[model samples]
Target: MVTAISGFEPTSLSLVAELIGTAVFAASGASAAVGKRLDLFGVVVIGTLCALGGGAVRDILIDAKPLVLTDWRYPLVAVLASLVVFRFHPALSRMRPTMLVLDAAGLALFTVVGTLKGLDYGFAVYAACIVGVLSGIGGGILRDVLVQEIPAVLREDFYAMAAVIGAIIVSVGARWESQIGHWTLMLIAIATIFVVRMVAIRYRWQAPKPNI
Candidate 1:
C-alpha cells in the first residue's frame, strides 16, 4: 500500500530529469577538474563521481542497486558530458554565470527526482525529503572533497536550504497530488528552488552565524 503520486514513473519525467541532472553535474565536475589542471582521465573520474555519487548513495541507502551500476546510459551520459566540458572548458570557465545557472538547474532537478524515487521506494515523506536533499548536494560534496575544497552546501549561499525547500514541496505535493497535479507540483518545486538559490546568490544571503 505504498502508492506514489500518479504518473510518477521511472520511464517518464523522473527518468528524463535524472539524466539531465547527471549531465549538468558531470559537466560541473569536469569543469572543476579542468580548472584544477587535472588530466582528462582525472576530469572524467571527477565527472563520474559528481554525476553518479548522489544517486548511487541514495539507492544504497534505500537498499536498492545504484542506477549507475545497472544502467549503461547513466555513466555514458556522464562521460560524454565530461568530455564535452573538457573540450570547451576554456570558454565555459569564462562563463561563470552560465555555469552557476546550470548548477542550480541540476540541483533542482535532482531534488525533485530524488524525492520521487524515494517515494517510489516507499519511504515516508520526511525521509524522502532527506533523500532529495542528499541527492541535490551529494555530487557537489564529492567533487569538492576530491579537490580538497569546502563543499558548496557548507558555504553561505543557501544551497542546501534551497534543496530542502524543494524536497518539502515535492514531499507535500505527493500527498496532495489530487489538489495540485503532480506535474504542476514538480515544476513549481523546481522553479522555486532555482529562484531561491539564484536570489540568494544575487543578494549574498547567508544563514545567521555565531557572533564569535
Candidate 2:
C-alpha cells in the first residue's frame, strides 16, 4: 500500500520527483524544438512550457496562481535541464532508455500533485480526475501545439489513459482515508502508465483510426 504523504512537508522523495519530472519534460520539449530547428529562445519557451504547463493548468482550474510563477526554482530547473540536454545531444540521444524512464517518473509525480491539489480545492472526485489527467498531459499538449503538430493525447499511445488510471487510483485512495493506500495507488498508477507506454512502444501499439 502506498503511503499518503500529501500533507507531509516537502520530503527528499517529493523534491526529487519534482526535479526529475521537470527535467524529463524539459528535455522532451527541447528535443522537439531541435527537431523544428527552433532558435535558442524558442527552445527555452517550449521547454519551460512543457515543464510547467500541466501544473499551471491544474492550478488555474483550482483557482490558485500557478506554483511555477511563485517559485523561480521551477523555471531554473527547466532551463538547466534543457541546457544539459542541448549540450550533450549526441550522448543523450543514445540514452533513450533513460529518457523513457524519466518521462514515466515525471508523469507519475505530476499526476499525484494534480489530484492532491484538486482535492485541496474541494473538488469532487470527477473534477479531481479531470484535473489529474490534464496535469499529466498538459505539458505534452502544449509542446505539440508549439510545434504545430497533433497532440500526443489524441494519437496512438496510452498517454492520456495512463493519466486517467493514475487519477482514478489517487481519487479512490483519497476516499479511503488511508495514506498508505493513497501512495500505493499512486505508485501503481505511475508504474502502470510507464509499463503500458513502454510496452506500447515496444509492440507498436496504437489506437484505431476513424474510418473516414
Candidate 3:
C-alpha cells in the first residue's frame, strides 16, 4: 500500500521546493526547444514533458498515480515556468551558467525525493536507487527526444552518476539513526552534485568513450 509521509504536510517548504524544481526543469526544456525554433505548442509540450516526465515514470514504476495528475499545482508550476522562459527569451538565452546550476539543483532534489518516496512505498533499496536515478534523468531524456538530440544523460557528463551518488547518500543516511541524518544527507548530496557538475563542466571531465 502507498503510504504518505506524515507530519510533512504539503506546506510551504514542500510546495516551494517542488515549484522551484519544476520551473527550472521546464525552463531548461523550453529553452532548448526555443533554441531550435520550435513552434509555441511544441515548446509548451517540451516544457511540460520535462517538468513531469520523470515523476510520471517514477509513479508508474512504483504502482502509484502520478502526483502531477493528482495535484493540480504541478502543471500550473510547469506552465508558469515555461511562460517565464518564453517571455524573457533574450535574457535567458545568455544565462547558460545559471541554467546549468538550476539543472544541478533540480537533479539533486529530485533524486532524494524519488528515493525517499520509493522507500515509503516499501520498495527494496535496489529498486529505490533505480527509481531515484530514473526520476533524475527522465525529464532530460524527454527534452532531448522533443529536440531530436541524443539525451544528455547518455553523454560524457556525470548526469546520472551525480544522481546515483545523491541517492546513495540518502539511502545510507536513512540506514543510520542519526537525528538530522536525513536532512544532512540531502544537503550533502545536493552540494556534492552541484560542485561535481560545476567542476566537470570547468575541466571538461567525461566518462571514457568506448574504444571500438
For each candidate, the alpha-carbon lDDT, in order, equals 0.87, 0.81, 0.81
lDDT (10s digit) by residue, model 3, range 96-205: 88888888888888887888788778888788888988888899898998798999789868777878887877766666625654556667767777777777778878
lDDT of 3: 0.81
lDDT of 2 at 104: 74
Candidates 1 and 2 compared: the better one by TM-score is: 1
Any residue pairs clashing in model 1, and if so which? none
Off by over 4 Å in 2: 1-10, 179-181
lDDT (tens digit, per residue) of candidate 2 on 50-121? 989989999988988898989787889999887776677678888978887788778877887788778878
Model 1 segments more than 4 A misplaced: 1-14
* TM-score per model over all chains: 0.91, 0.89, 0.91
Scored against the true structure, residue 163 in model 2 reaches a CA lDDT of: 73
**Candidate 1 lDDT by residue in tens digits, 1-212:** 22354545645656787788889899999988998999999999999999999888889888888989899989999999999998998887788898788889999988888888898889999999998889889988999999989886797669999999999998988888767876788889999999999998899888777789
Clashes of 1: 0
What RMSD, rounded to one decimal, does every model reach? Answer: 2.2, 2.7, 2.4
